[model samples]
Target chain A: MKKFFLGFALVSLLIAGVLSYFASGDPDGLDKTVEDTGIAAHAQEHPFAGSTFADYALGGDSKFTGLAGALGVIVVLAVSFSLFWFLRKRPDAR
Target chain B: MHMSDGLLNAPVSVAFLVIAAVGVGFALVKARADLDDRTAPMAGLVATFIFAVQMINFPILPGASGHLLGGALAAILVGPYVGALCVTIVLVVQALLFADGGLTALGANVTNMALIGTATGFVVAVALRRLAERGKGGLAAVAFVSAFVNTVVAATGFVVEYAIGGAGGVEIGKVALLMWGLHALIGIGEGLITAATVTSVAAIRPDLVYLLRGSRKPLEVRS
Candidate 1:
């Protein structure tokens, strides 16, 4: 089970690390719909829009997409894993 | 879909924040039922995988692309409660660190993508799984349909929120039609990606798949 979990996490990291760079730059479905309907103008700047990893780019540079993605995966993995680790059922208590 | 800050009025936004809090708080408590020491890591991995996949946007139409919402995918892989929490975790991280979603609009995004999407997908899967034949293919098919429906229903969630307190002057009917249509196309991508991933995991370690737990299909591979 440990090996399987490691392999799964590795594959996810690989995808986020590498494949994310090739994702299309086009607007997503919701974005495109809002654009078409002209409601996009109502969309406000996110508070953290100027952050390092905003828009999945590092320092607003598209060249660093893979790095940004890898970092995101790591952060998400760490935070979520810690949460689940603490929350998991303890059989010994019973 | 991730709503920006100005898309909704303050009242509606606050309402959803409360709504999201109650919903997520409920899920957080309920998630324990699904998580044993052995399966907790699986739930975490599901969160990471969904985050990774969401970064890759596959083109759906001429000017539109779609990414995996992963609510259905997570729900199918993990149980629904844990799956909702997984998606909520991703949305929180994205909103705070990545700015992929709005901070003020976080509640709405959580409600739509995490709660509504996961519940829809799980319900759809449960309804159809019994009718689906006992094979990996059957499981994959159910996953596909479940994910497809999840996307559409979640899209409806956005439209409902929009109707309540949309800041723009756009027609509600028009927005509804456009959202539903675009998401319908996007849902196909969601279905295919979900089916492929679920099938692969089920093939390698069928025991880890929560959706397949009730089936007595006697899968040949379990490592």
Candidate 2:
């Protein structure tokens, strides 16, 4: 079980850190809908747009974006692990 | 789809935030009561996996792309309650850390992606699985259909929210049509990914799949 968990975590890291660099650069479905319908004009910048990792890019470098992606995955994992750890029903581990 | 800030008026955004909060609150309670040691780890892992995959977009057209929503995928792997919570966690992180989703519109995104998507997908998948009355392959087929339908439904959710609180002059009807149509294509990719993942996991660790729980019958894998 531990092996499977480790392997899965490693795979997730690779996908976020490396494969994410290959993701398409086009607007996503929602963004395209906004643009095609002329609603893009009303779209405003996200409140956190100026954050170091805003838009998943950092320091104007693609490599930084990859680093950001990996960091995001790890952060999410850690946070979620903590949340689930506290919330999950543990029936007295034998 | 991550709805950005200013897309919907303040009233609309607040309303969704309230709604999403209620849904998430309920899910948190339910998931807490239901999760075990095994499922606890699976839930965290599923959320992490989803966060990673959501970064990878596949092109649907010349200038458009879509990524995994992962609501159905999570619900099938874990339970619906845990699945919704997982998605909510991912969305929260994306909004706060990556700014990938809008901060003010976080509520709206949570409602569409986490609440509606997981609820609809889980219900549909379970219904179809029972109807199919087959085995592993059939479960995967059902997962595909449910995930596809969930994406469409979630997209429709945005359209509904937009109509209520549209900040732009765009025609709501046209926007709905485009959103639904494009999302249908995106949903195809979601279905394929969900199906493949569910099938793979079901093959090796069928016990881990929430959908297949409590089944005494043999799950014949049709090659």
Candidate 3:
């Protein structure tokens, strides 16, 4: 069970990493709607916009940043999966 | 559709936040009955699948591309509450980690795409399932219709938000109409994919399809 979850977590993170590259830079439905409606500029920059992890890229444009983003996703997924597993794993809890 | 912060008026945003909070609470409560050891992993896996599939985009018009919102898909495959929770988790992750959506707009996105879309889709699916009870190939049809309706509804939600906070003087009616029309077409694509996915799962594991419960026994054709 542990192995299955660990594998699932790793794979989920890997999928996120790969998809992040192909995700459309074109504005999504909401963004396009706002732009078409002329309210696009009204959108606020996120408070975390200055974070290195913002925009799915690491700080520098080096290959390291890309690799870091992928690794970071893995780390987050691992933690999230672990937390869920721990909470739900209690035999009597369910 | 992710409505970023400042894209919606404070009133509208707050309204959605309240709505989302209630929806999440309801989902958490309802999902308790459905969250067995087996179903838990399945729920997680289904969420992952939806997340992966959402990356595949189809062109909307000449230059626009849209991806699967998957609220209806999840709701039909899983229960409504679980469906809402799954999509909410996906949206939250997208906003915080992938930066695909805005953090401040999380509540609005959850309300529109997760709560409204999933609940409406589940209701539609339930109604259609009842209607198609004894018919062959009915499950697929219901799944398609549910997905279609969900997308259209979410698109409408987007238009309403824009009308309230539109920094531009564009006519609200025009924006609403245009968004609705385009999304109607997009809804068809969503319906097809969702129907295909749901029907495939129903064929193998009908028990996994919460919406199709009590509809009919799965057919087994032996060669």
Candidate 4:
């Protein structure tokens, strides 16, 4: 079971690290809808616009998208795993 | 879809934020019943996978692309309560660290993708449990339909939010129609990816699939 999970996590990390670089840079559905409807003009830059890893990259550089994505996967995994660790029901209880 | 901070008005944003907080809080409490040694790890892995797949935006139309929302996939695999937590965690992380979703609009995003998306998907998955337990193909079909509907329903959530307090000159009707059309196309991609992933997971270890817990198809080997 551990091996299966590790393999699954490894594959996910690889996809985020490698294939994410090849993802289309075009606007997503919502963005494109807003743009097409001309409502995009009303969109505001989020407060996190100046975040260190804004737009899923280091310094908003495209070259580091893969690295950024991989880091995000790790962070999300760690956070979720830790959260569930405390939340999970112990067998001895009921 | 990750909406920016500017898309919604402050009042609407705050309202949705409160709604998201309630929904996520409820899920946090409910998730305890679903999480055990096996599913705790499974839920964590599902969340990581969602974060990873969300980065791979596939082109759906001329200039529009879409990515896996993962609501249905997560719900089917780990049960809806834990699934909602997984998605909320990803959304919160993305808003805070990755700048993927807007900080102000985080509540709306969570409400749509985490609460609405997972709830609808889980409902559909449960409704089709018999078919989903038939075989891998059956499960994939159920996954695809649930995911497809999840995307569309989640997109409709945005439309509803926009109708309530949209601060733009665009016609509400236009927003609704375009959103539906675009999301329909995006949903197809979401469906395919979800089907593939769910089928693959069910094939290897059916025990991990929450929706398939009582199915008579695959024999579970206790590890």
How far does residue B210 in candidate 3 sit from its true spot (Å)?
Answer: 0.9
Off by over 4 Å in 4: B217-223
Candidate 1 chain B, which ten residues in sequence have the lowest lDDT sum? B214-223
Q: Select the stronger candidate by lDDT from 1 and 4.
A: 4
> How many pairs of residues in model 4 come into backbone collision?
1
Best-performing candidate as measured by lDDT:
4
Better of 2 and 4 by lDDT: 4
Clashes of 2: 0
Give one digit per residue, the lDDT tens place, for model 2 in A34-83: 98887878878988888888888895456677799889889988988889
Report the C-alpha displacement of residue A21, candidate 3, in angstroms.
5.2
- Candidate 2 lDDT, tens digit per residue, B61-151? 9999999998899988898999999999999999998888887799999999999999989989888767323776688789899999999
Share of the reference A-B contacts seen in candidate 2 = 0.83
Q: TM-score for each prediction?
A: 0.97, 0.96, 0.82, 0.97
Clashing pairs in 2: none
True contacts kept of each: 0.78, 0.83, 0.27, 0.83
Give the winner by lDDT: 1 or 3.
1
Winner of 1 and 3 under TM-score: 1
Candidate 1 structure quality by residue, lDDT tens digits, B1-223:
7878888888999999999999999999999988988789988899999999999999888777888999889998888999999999999999988899888889999999999999999999888776443676788889899999999999999899989998877899998998899899989999999999888888888888887786776565333
DockQ of each: 0.83, 0.82, 0.32, 0.84
Q: Where is model 3 more than 4 Å wrong at Cα?
A: A1-25, A57-94, B130-136, B164-166, B219-223
Candidate with better DockQ, 1 vs 4: 4
Off by over 4 Å in 2: B131-133, B218-223
Cα lDDT listed for each candidate: 0.88, 0.87, 0.70, 0.89
